[model samples]
Target: MQRTILIVEDEDILREIMKDYLLNAGYRVLEAADGKEALARFEEEEIQLIILDIMLPELDGWTVCRRIRKKSNVPIIMLTARVDEDDTILGFELGADDYVTKPYSPAILLARAKRLIESRYSTQENHPYEDTLLSRSVHVHIPSRTVTVCGEAISLTHTEFEILTYLMQNQGIIISREQLITKIWGYEFAGDDRTVNSHIRNLRHKLGKCATCIVTVVRAGYKFEEQI
Candidate 1:
């Protein structure tokens, strides 16, 4: 089945370019010129992914993302032209699965979109960690893709969940930022270390008391150690 992607960009030329690439990549494409129209299309279609631009009219991308996250966990990749690192962090905080800045290669954007969509809809029956990963009070059920701390469920964005799972899967081993970028966002990831840091910060916050399980190694990377 051809996956459907909604492109919410206010720029007509850029939107058409993205739509063309997605169509050629064998995906069904939907388009909206503004945030409000984006929301309407979202409500009307079975959108598998969203490529949203920040500077939209009628409503901003941040507002649209926050609203959609309330109802669905569908993958969303935010598009921005700003160089501010805070914008990237804000996107993650608003439940965005990926971020692409302006002047980006449409092919790279498509790759990111594909990665998120596939990861979300993967049907692999035999995962390496079929059982639950219990480290101290943090419980990660691989099959169900659910995380619970002290038996209390906590919400995690897709990227945050992947980061924690990878860390826990290789507990006691320091995983570098490069390794994480390749594993989670693919090699096409054009962001810097701050991207990883932002996600880690958010993940740790959600982990609460169990946050100590993830230890940062100065000048090295990060590792998961069982914390009691």
Candidate 2:
């Protein structure tokens, strides 16, 4: 299946550059000059991935990401020129799956986009059963990629879901941050331990009463254990 990628960048030249790369790579490309337009195009198209620019006009990328995440868990790769750690953390908090700084190679961007898109499809195709993990009051259905805490459905980003799934699959093993970064985002992922921390924080917050199931090991990593 030919995947569609939405490029949400205001700069005409940059947008064209990204679109050209994706098109040449055989993906169906859509363009949006600003965040509002990006959201509209997202709602209208069967987009598998989104390359969103943080400095967009209208609603801005943060707003766009927050809104879309509330409705869908489609992988989002945020593009920005800023190298501020806070900005990257904020993007993660808003449900972005990946981050790419500006002045980057289109090849790199394409690689990131491809990884996210392929990961999503591969996960679905490879898992066919209603394989589920239950601990405490949290339940995660692997095949359907859905989670519920205390019987209430919870929304999670792609990365967040993957992390939770991996942890729950292992149950009591302490998975280090490096291991998690490699397993979930691949060896090429640019972000470090803080990225994993941010996602965990978000995941815990969403888990609410069942948050105790995930425990942070001192000077170690994180583990999933049934809380008594």
Candidate 3:
């Protein structure tokens, strides 16, 4: 089935434009003019993702986001007209999966929606039912995209989780920094190799005693091995 996406915006033109783009991209699109309708549709549909505008009628997007987050982890990309950095930070703090500033291209919005949805769900498809990876005190559930160290669950952002999964899946292989950047962020990924290094560092830190499983190579990128 095509993924269903909810477009919540008070502006008729923007909502219609977004709906058209998602439909053309082969997603099943749902539209709402305000937070009230948006929540109703959210409860009534199996929406895979959401494109929510900050300013809305009847109810506001921030409240809607907070409410939605209380119940689900469905990917949401916030749309804001203001360029204020605080708004962007607040959106993420409220558990928005991503965000875009106003006057953004519908095509770019569609691309981001696609990436977030895929990143949130597609990781499960690459693993077998019993494909749990183990090294020392660390246990990774590939099918579930879950990681545990010493019987405790660890929270990871989508990017961090993806990098760790990719590294572990390619265990012992010398994955270059460039290769990691491309794999996680795509060819259009703008950040330098240092971005990959930062995420790798974060992953290791979160891995606690099992941090040694991921080894950094001087000229090479990085590798994951029980022997590391």
Off by over 4 Å in 3: 123-138, 152-160, 163-228
Which candidate should be chosen as best, given TM-score against the real structure?
A: 2
lDDT for every model? 0.90, 0.90, 0.79
lDDT of 1: 0.90
**Per-model root-mean-square deviation over C-alphas:** 1.8, 1.8, 4.6
1-228: candidate 3 lDDT, tens digit per residue: 588999999999998899989989999999999999999999999988989999999889999998997787677888989877667667766666566888988877887888877766765555443468776677778666678988998866566666777877788898999898777666654446545656676678888888888888889889888763
Misplaced by over 4 Å in model 2 are: 123-130
TM-score-superior candidate, 2 or 3: 2
lDDT score at residue 114, model 2, on the 0-100 scale: 87
lDDT of 2 by residue, 47-105 (tens): 89999999989989999999999889999999999999999999999999999887899
Question: How close is every model to the real structure, measured as TM-score?
Answer: 0.92, 0.93, 0.69
Please give the TM-score that candidate 3 achieves against the real structure. 0.69
For TM-score, candidate 1 versus 3, the one ahead is 1
| Model 1 CA deviation exceeding 4 Å by range | 126-128
- Residue 83 of model 2 has an lDDT of 97
Model 2 earns a TM-score of 0.93
